[model samples]
Target: MATPLTAPTTDPGCRVLGLRERKKQRTRDALVDAAHRLFLTQGYGRTTVDEIAASVDVSQRTFFRYFANKEEVALAVMSDAEDYFIDCLRRRPADENPLQAMRAAITEAWLELGQDDQSGPAGVTAALELFELLETTPTLLAAHLRRTTEQEGVVAGVLAEREGLDAAVDLRPRLLAAVFGAVVRLSHLSWTSDTAAHAAGPDGMIALIERHFDQLGPALAGSWR
Candidate 1:
């Protein structure tokens, strides 16, 4: 079980994993909140994990238990969207074309139909700040790449089922799934990086994805060998 962020210390043989999990979560949350504040006030390169721990009143060792280091904290926080995407991908239809199923699922999961059309207002600004931070940090960039790899595997597994492919289909769907998922991700990146003109807000994400499917449709269809 994952450790909770709030645990001061745990017995080597403690029985309640749930409490420990919650404690670890609390500690991780504290560290992230501290680090985020420090990042904005002092800048990303200027911040340190020790300083984040100090600000949160946790020992640096406790901080390490939740995240290997400061970069990992940013990685963990920035990964929430990808994590959500994985869950939605799993819930998509087993029979529908993988890309088409993705269209409805992604829109319903992340885009609110009314209002600002971004994420919820309560969390929008924080998410945007995190997006901006990822733009410049190489460590976070690498972590994001690894996150994308995991998402690609998810897409491939769903595609295999949707296409009713057997073991003989080997490498085909894997590449297509990765390509499609990457384009979908890039569409959101464009939206996040430049939102000033997004009158449709995040709806631009789905529209951009549709354009990819349209442009690539002939290519995708022809390759179903």
Candidate 2:
């Protein structure tokens, strides 16, 4: 779900439309911005595709050209962050253990996202806003859960590939991935609590993750306070 904003075309013919491509990129950005604002105001279910397009002064056809549906647009920014996390996971040091790799990769991904790039501060704020929306919206929450489950399988496959094991045959990779996913879910749940002091930004989320991860060993050991 790479946005045209940062995606470079490798096709030779695409080189000819360098200026044209820039214009299209601007359109894509405008549509995404409009969609986010509309969704925030009208709610996800109430926001129609036509209205979103109308907000950007584009036709529904143009919106369809950039995004297949409202869901795609709603999740597009978060999707980019997810993609970066996966890529970071893949590039982690092979010698590291699974948990260590996961932590390091995620930390790097968060750090990278905090930079002055496309999805920097503004995008982080937008993502957090959408996350809060998803939490309260049943439809979007279900979709988010489904994506989380699917991502666990994808990550398990990546782990299996790294460990030189058949993902279908080796249960260890899948088991570890599931456990890791649960940890992430729990961390998010704790961090999202109304009384939680975390900033709701990249740094705050990272701190919550690290804190929860640090507790995994003690929890497994069944140590009482």
Candidate 3:
């Protein structure tokens, strides 16, 4: 089943105070942060939305404004990485094969992710912190899997758009996207195992992803075709 996305709420209740989409994003961020910390403390399934709502200093309704359920939000909250991932996909050179382009782009992009918040994106430590929190908790595991699966549809769409009504265009792009997400997630889990080692930023990650491409590059062949 397609996971339901909650419509952005428009209500400006005392606690909410604005248009649904803006309110939704803020509330989502707040609730996710709260749940993240709480999961680290109380365990994932044990941390109730009510508790998350309480910690974020918002009421139940305010929490609902952003997430349909604690599971969906908690599971999906850390997914801000997709934007960077998409950017990497876009960075492929015009002359490069789609797969090779994606590989190079991802390698370079991951290096960018290693930069400190001062460099503007979530730094090495932050990425590991989020990954660590997710790794240790089985409750959030299913949610993580679900979120990863959801990313395939997104990748598929990106791939489909690149092809201009070509009858022979294969489903390779969607398959490639799935494989790419899996590889990236695997690489992330590996690097984050001792994030401090990669704290200097992209150099280590570029090396790691380059190695991943050595093994997995074929999966992305003709993906953007």
Candidate 4:
């Protein structure tokens, strides 16, 4: 967990000299930005923690202050999306069914992402490339999978609370969360492989996900060969 940022303070004969919280945030962001650039260009396996810290003119100790390892830095980019989805899920209306709520939450999350300036111009192309990096790199893939598992548990607990079920005792909440996660992973694999899909970019990925959600009914209820 991140240490809570301290509020600026002042007292008689005392002064808050600078924006300590903002400076820490900037350093953390710079480390992530530099790491992503190196990981994208030189590849994750080739990049070293020292190089990441040096790129930001910070010490190895400073880098460790922000992230435990290179894998943590690599996943920080994706963590924003994860956080957005969970926040949206928590805010969805009580009347909506589980699947409907998931869909609506993701839609809102993506809409907010579209308006946000943070993604910037290394662009969606860089983001997709990073996804490809995760898919192909063993160490990164393992880390990604671990994060995915942790997020699934979070989603399941959220679902249980919203539906008034005991998450520990009832299986429905976990089952739905598992299915939703599987669909997301499957959609990613399908979207990444279709060479013809490159031109569509982020929108194409979203469309693929929507199509997968559309099939969830038949996928769960109908027979398969």
Candidate 5:
């Protein structure tokens, strides 16, 4: 997963930060990196804020300064990816339908994420390991589901905007978003269980996601004989 903290600046107007801000950024990044390593090695349930902070040689209070709690820091990587995915969806061409926009957006998002893994702080291997941990960890999985439900509303609003439809009155956007979210959840579950997919990493997961999306129409409309 691309550590959004360390992602290269793409904005032409990006300003050079002062020393204090740069130092803070470094601290936050260190905390996130330490948290991920501890979570993966010792298990999220067993890892605590103190241990993460200690690993980064910072006070526990400093960890709380950047993240609300262990869960927040633990899921920061996934949150960054989600934010990027939404941004990509918003940038999709207006002519494409909601489903097409979503499909293209996710593909684009994953491709960029994969590229970042090769050169970024946490590679795809760490990402896949973290993903498996998230799926198996009950508390994290529940929190993830709750976050996904909320994110669906945001996605639906984006879809509604693209179509010039009021999401409050029009059910299509919300309904489609729900279905898309479900498909993604199912794909995650499938990928987590498939040993071969684990070996294939991001590319394999992307293929599985595409396959799930392709099956959506047939799975919904066709009779199982």
Candidate 6:
């Protein structure tokens, strides 16, 4: 069964951030919004840093202060989502196994994002478009894959901490992390290739991931005959 979406709590620190920090955050958000809009409307490759900066009415130097390059801004939303999933994983119940924790964390994170009013309907639509954009664009796809690889270690470390294992010495955490990541990547590939799945959007991708995770045990341990 799917987990029900719950309201996200506001961080008290957000309220206490000084005026300068708040202003910086607003500028950063504006830049991200502008970048996504440009990336979706114009092809990611065609969108320039100057154009993104211009859209936010910020100078190119100010844009560089927030993001290193166009690719960084292009991926900023996804990076935030990944961070949220890590946060969710950290909060998962200790009784759950690593794979179960990972699966639940991702589902919880996506559901929360889907229900967020700040994200809105237009934001959801943009996310769907961005998924397609990432899959089709070679440069972005390569960068995305590289980022995914880098994140596996972080996930493994989290799992290790949960299980009280040494991630560097004990390979189980890393193994589980690799398997989980592979399952997610496979689901994404399948989603992108199938027209029907692609049409179903983020929900379809999540369902597909759940189905693939369900098959892991059977595929690894059960006989084909």
Q: All models: lDDT?
A: 0.61, 0.73, 0.60, 0.75, 0.81, 0.77
RMSD of each: 7.0, 4.2, 8.0, 6.4, 2.7, 4.5
User: Which ranges in model 6 have alpha carbons more than 4 Å from their true place?
Assistant: 1-18, 117-122
lDDT per residue, candidate 2, 78-186, as tens digits? 7666666777788888998878888887778767665533442125655666777888888778877888888889889888888889989989888888888888777
Weakest 10 consecutive residues of candidate 5 by summed lDDT: 4-13
Winning candidate number (TM-score): 5
Cα-based lDDT at residue 185, candidate 6:
80
Q: What residue runs in model 2 are displaced by over 4 Å at the alpha carbon? A: 1-26, 117-122, 194-200
TM-score to true structure, per model: 0.69, 0.82, 0.67, 0.85, 0.90, 0.86
Order of candidates by lDDT, top first? Answer: 5, 6, 4, 2, 1, 3
Better of 3 and 6 by lDDT: 6
Choose 1 or 4, whichever is better by lDDT.
4
lDDT of 3 by residue, 4-92 (tens): 12213322121434565565565665676677667666766687889989987899898887778876666553465555566666655
Clashing pairs in 3: 9-20, 111-202
Return whichever of 2 and 4 wins on TM-score: 4
Q: How displaced is residue 65 in candidate 2, in Å?
A: 2.1
lDDT of 1 by residue, 1-225 (tens): 122211224322334457666576566666766777777667788998889899878888888887887777765544655555555666777766666777766665455322222232213344445655677787777777787787777767766766777524677667876777667656656767555524454455557666666767776566655
Residue pairs in candidate 6 whose N, alpha carbon or C atoms collide under 3 angstroms: none
Candidate 3's displacement at residue 50, Å, is 1.7
Best candidate according to lDDT:
5
3 or 4, greater by TM-score: 4
Q: What are the per-residue Cα lDDT tens digits for candidate 4 across 77-195? A: 67756766888899899999988899888767655554432343233445555778889999888888898899999999999999999999999989899899888887778778877
Between candidates 2 and 6, the TM-score winner: 6
- Ranked by TM-score from best down, the candidates are 5, 6, 4, 2, 1, 3
lDDT for model 4: 0.75
Candidate 2, residue 23: how far the Cα is off, in Å: 4.9
